[model samples]
Target: MSRSVSRGVVALLLSCALLLTTGACGGGDDKTSASAAEAPTASASFEQQKLAKTRFVANAGLAAGATYQWIVKPYRAGKFKKGADGRTFALVKAGLAGAFTYNRLKAAVNNAKGDPLLSKAVAPLSAGIESLKDLGTKLRKGEAGDADVGAFENIINSVKDAGKSAGAEVVDKVPSASQLGGG
Candidate 1:
């Protein structure tokens, strides 16, 4: 191949590779490279990131409620059993995972200072997380009653409304009180 054409092709390939892989091009300066980890959050400006984090928090709040529903649907019929032990264990594990995600998301919401509307939703979501943890503990101890289930469901429903107020579609699949098995 001609030298000019070969160099052009090499440059094209290098640019494409750099674009696809992050931190690919510039690695000369130590100070700038150290700040690169914050690059994504920096690109949109902190205000934009605060708004995006608020939306992310709303979605995560809804997901935390959904996780409880995911584990509780099977247990609507009876208590924890020997065969159900694995499922119960899995549910509790999932609940803990949801807790971690929710707590982090909540922290993000708290840190989102630019948007004042997002702050209003924090309380119900916090209550929902507390109830979720309580439900997991009750289920683990084999002391979960219909009342406990009802309370968890109620807290999740309240959080769904709170999320909507915070500008998220959280109640898309949530049932009415009658559809919640009316215990």
Candidate 2:
């Protein structure tokens, strides 16, 4: 074999071996990984599922509260105390809060996996994450307006209703900027 060809083969073999040992290449029966840790070993209990549902509701409620505090109320009152810059800040703040809430809600849903009742109630809410994300993107770009705000409120209402059906309803709880991790 040529020297270059032999060197290439040797490098490839070494890389494969390293990957197999580290369980990165899925070369063996070893399935251990960080993601595996997140997977439930067994179906969640009813109480556990309810708790997760409650958590999802609370997180979503925070986003709703943040929207009202930073966007809706001010817009309705026609008092953007800080002017355009302040309006921009409110939009960005609400957007980040929504994003954060979506992530937390996702985690809660994952934790409640295998519970059909809770899952059914949470499905629509989870599916709305994309729309929520898009709203946030629009807000940040200063392209969001009354229609976007109305859509956001409708989403929040749907989530609240779902939470109620699942017996996990929670009032809106405004989260701090630090909590949203967007400050």
Candidate 3:
């Protein structure tokens, strides 16, 4: 199959993995096994895959945005920090570090290159890592710039919009900027 299709398929499969914490799929309590007749086993459609990709990315985006804002809040008032708060920064950083090690995010980025909308939003989502890397560098230098902060906010908004475009599935999981501790 084409690369985009493969990516979409991967995205759908990984949805369960992405939401493992929330017990979204089979891992949760399976209290009911009343129906023996299973649905058709056909693969997810292109649209379905796209929706899954959008949902995963959007949730991830909002989480990243919240992390960025959490880390940068001390510096949001036009004041660069000598050092970011260890606990708050660690909250986001540790999670990001874990995601980088995930096959899901990596596969979606590598395989979804042909999907225009998914690909478009993926760039900003990927750039979030770069922003975090910059944060690491800034930590060494003992200061942060407005540009990094602005870029992260833009990335967050892009993620929010992309998720919203997927309809309720994605939008429902995304937190507002204020909910993310906006200034």
Give lDDT tens digits, candidate 3, residues 1-183.
996567645644543244333222221112221121122333434444454465466445545444344444544543344443343334333233223322223333433342455556566567554444444334323344576555545654555565455332223233443223211
Q: For every model in order, what is the number of clashing pairs?
A: 0, 0, 0
Evaluate model 2: give its TM-score.
0.62
Model 2, range 96-169, lDDT digits (tens) per residue? 54455555444545533434666687676666655665665565455767887777777777767766787767
Off by over 4 Å in 1: 1-46, 49-62, 65-69, 79-114, 124-128, 171-183
TM-score of each: 0.47, 0.62, 0.40
Clashing residue pairs for model 3: none
| Least accurate 10 contiguous residues by lDDT in model 2 | 23-32
**Residue 83 in candidate 1, Cα distance off native in Å:** 7.9
lDDT of 1 by residue, 1-183 (tens): 996567656644643342243222112222333354356775545555455445445444544444455445645644344456444444443333233333433443443333455556655456555545545445534566667656656655665565567665453342222222111
Error of 1 at 78 (Å): 3.0
Best by lDDT: 2
Worst 10 residues of 3 by lDDT: 28-37
Scored by lDDT, model 1 comes in at: 0.45
Best by TM-score: 2
Better by lDDT, candidate 3 or 2: 2
After superposition on all C-alphas, the RMSD of every candidate to the true structure, in Å, is 17.9, 15.2, 15.2
For each candidate in the order shown, give its overall lDDT on alpha carbons.
0.45, 0.56, 0.41
